[model samples]
Target: MAKAKWRSVDGIVLLNKPIGLSSNQALQRVRRLFQAAKAGHTGALDPLATGMLPLCLGEATKFSQYLLDADKRYLTCIQLGKRTTTGDREGDILTEESVPSLSDESLESILDGFRGEIEQIPPMYSALKHEGKPLYEYARQGIVIERKRRRVTISNLTLVSRTADTLTLDIQCSKGTYIRTIGEDIGEALGCGAHLHSLHRISTAGYSPENMMTMEEFEAISEQGYEALDAHLLPMDTAVEYFTKVDLPETDTMNMMFGRTIPSPVSLDNGTVVRMFDQGTQRFLGLGQIKGTMLRPFRLVNTSEFSL
Candidate 1:
């Protein structure tokens, strides 16, 4: 067999991750398909959850944190009348209660209570760290750590469908929002315990699940040729489109490349991050911060392989 030859692949690939695989697992598979020299995912998805997992390849890894900080949209199913130890189907049932006879008006009212900014206690069976160890590890050892309530914005919460024992919800929330916790809170509001049955992330930042390719589709695409697989990759700048754009002339651009702050024509508020590009050819240079009247280089791109 020929020795594997890896190449610098720079861009973002939106993956419609199937349930039962961790986000890193999906990223590794995609990285192998592209033979990428570097790769990372924006955020993680539970093994039981499915949908959009953005994989960053090569230079795109530098901007992955922006996607992690972005708002998320999810469609989740909540099973009423049963509370679980881990807040989802993966854990054992803790208790069971009778689901209330709820009307559309009652359900809407309950959902309304959860809308807008709210406080949420992060689940113990989460990836959050405690004393340098993961909270899930402590949870597995029956260690209950006192957790503080955190503020999270739930911009939209709507009832999608309902049955006697199960209700589906569409939620759009800020970073750090816990959907499982919301399901439990919603159940508590209805006088019944609950847990998340299934979850599907529909959107993260500005990317949508509609544009994602599943693992199976990717496997088939990989068989065609490496070029075919590379075609799915979005440019590195795709992750930073929300930032204000600024183009610098050759003199200022060179100054920034050498770690010097230079005068900028853009009048953004001080401390605002902007995407810097070459004024003449429209090539993406890197990122800069507006400090007073000067643009200070923050994170600079390492290669010309990724350009706007």
Candidate 2:
């Protein structure tokens, strides 16, 4: 029998993506740096935006779905008196309006209108799928389609600063919320149209930008004879840290590795997500769903250790 190729350690990388590069481009660079067989990012950020981008490698990719639903936070600057085709500075200026002079009190009042739940129509220049194709495809052909409004919650919206033509804001919003649209809406409320000039994602879920690393820094260290960068990599179970923990005995662990459900030692009446660990060795088995006394297999991690 031939031996399988051994890959490096598996985990997640919190990349502080630089501006002017797409998310996929950044992912490819990191993948090549690590010589990893598989890698995936939790979400996508636009080329013009920079911030905390979580890149999942190896088994960590299995948990990317959980991070996608997590909340995000951003700081953006919107230029009033101008509207762009792409709702951002990268697009051509389509229309221009006179800047309305307003006091800080007036601006704060307008921001208060967007503090709660609201519906927003996604911009045409997004990666949203329509009829099995991306919306950006239609946009490149100068075609615009009517987008439906999606309900999103804005947990926090504050005017950090304001100038004569640009308004800077700090916002914490739910998943799928668009800061570009919020900039446009704020302009409309203030009687002047606006467009996003700059955006920086400060955090995702609970992961902050302060913990991210730049591509340049990562590349520099790799070139200096560093073999393993796994120290900075977060464990796959880090995403599901909010879930409950369950330890299984040898028999139960063996049954689970064979794709069998077994009784759990802990009694969780309410359905809950749990991280399973081996009782003797304390090794991560995978994630499971607990209901009453039964633990059903959700995602098995030690599949390689067992044969069907």
Best by TM-score: 1
Instruction: Provide TM-scores for the models.
Output: 0.95, 0.93
lDDT digits (tens) for residues 150-243 of candidate 2: 9999999988988899989999999999899999999889787999999998988798677899999878766643254666788788877788
How does candidate 1 fare on TM-score? Answer: 0.95
Off by over 4 Å in 1: 1-3, 304-308
TM-score of 2: 0.93
Q: lDDT per prediction?
A: 0.89, 0.85
Clashes of 1: 0
